[model samples]
Target: MQSTEQLDEIWQDRAIESIINFVRSADGDFNCIEKLANAVSDPDSLQKIVEFLSSTSQGKQAFQKRPLLGNIDLQKLHRLPTNSLGYSFANHLLTNNLQPLQRKSVENDYEFFAAHITETHDLWHIVTGCDTNILGEIQLEAFYVAQLYASRFWLALITKNLLKTVIYDIELSTTYMDAIAKGWVMAKQAKPLFGIEWNLLWETPLEDVRNSLNIILPSS
Candidate 1:
């Protein structure tokens, strides 16, 4: 077995290289994303988040079952009732040609926490109405930063992207900041999504799910 220090170093090294590559291309990098998540994911944060999840009845069951969201059938979701969260999410994925996230190897409770967050990431985007565009990504990251406070990777990305935008177009930089502000505010008002069993809510009306979760979508 690898020592914890060795694993941390591996993630950190991979994360730095991946971030650099991602910045150069502006394309999504799954491996890099996972590495970044694991790099900053400390044991304390994991335990606290897990404990929060365990506080709820659904959360306790979620930890025990460890349902993988990626296993959800998009075809079935596409056939769900109109205006259903799952239907909308399925449509979003199909329209964007985005695939479900693959499960990452989880060696411990901390790693499981990071993996769970990564797996449910797109579901958060759907409920929040954030697009898959670059600006949308920054906004969503801002939201995550507000809700989860431990992502140095997001902060770095936000800073670098903001600088890039400022140099490319002053007006666009303003727009990006607006998106970030909205994300922060929306996250502040939203219910914690940490342990939500999204599979159970697929049939729920999209509006109802948003209302229940206190989710405020961004203005188009």
Candidate 2:
């Protein structure tokens, strides 16, 4: 007779179902991305990911302290210089009407990854100069794929979204691929975003932050 814990240990769920569902009906829901990530996550997988991150100097620094941005007061961020990362991020949130989506209790590597990534997600858009649109989101995922900084979690998201584009939305297919290519290219030109202390750079000029990270934005 298998104990409940024994069964849980032996039984592993595949990410296919979640990926397919997100593809078919995500319609730009961020929660779908969240759910998809959660679907494929387990201790062993997260440990591998953490191990990979630990290999890089930036990732090593990031993990040594395991920085978590949590939430910030948007109003305070808005007070920063207009050309600063903080102001731009605050403006982005205000324009999109999104909360900072504070950190959850992170007791393990997976939780820490999810919490920090979620907290910094919009900040990536700001620095990358990607808009809050389908194309922009796809590009960022593609960037994440190239960097592998987010691990296989992004691979699953990009795979589903790319399939969705090709299988159903044929008209935008070319543009989608172009965006992905540009994002992939963008990765080669930048430093690791994982270990960046973005919160500390809030008052720094946005361009300076980008330059420090060696970010090469695609033309508008």
For candidate 2, lDDT tens digit of each residue in 103-166? Answer: 7567766677667777888988888887778889888988877765446777777688779878
> What stretches of model 1 exceed 4 Å from their correct place?
1-22, 29-35, 38-65, 104-107, 166-170
Highest TM-score model number? 2
Q: Residue 145's C-alpha lDDT in candidate 2?
A: 73
Model 2 lDDT-worst window of ten: 7-16
Candidate 2 residue-pair clash tally? 0
- Cα-lDDT of candidate 2: 0.79
lDDT (0 to 1) per candidate: 0.75, 0.79
Tell me which residue pairs clash in candidate 2.
none
Number of the top lDDT candidate: 2
- Tens-digit lDDT track of model 1 for 182-210: 88899999987766878889999999999
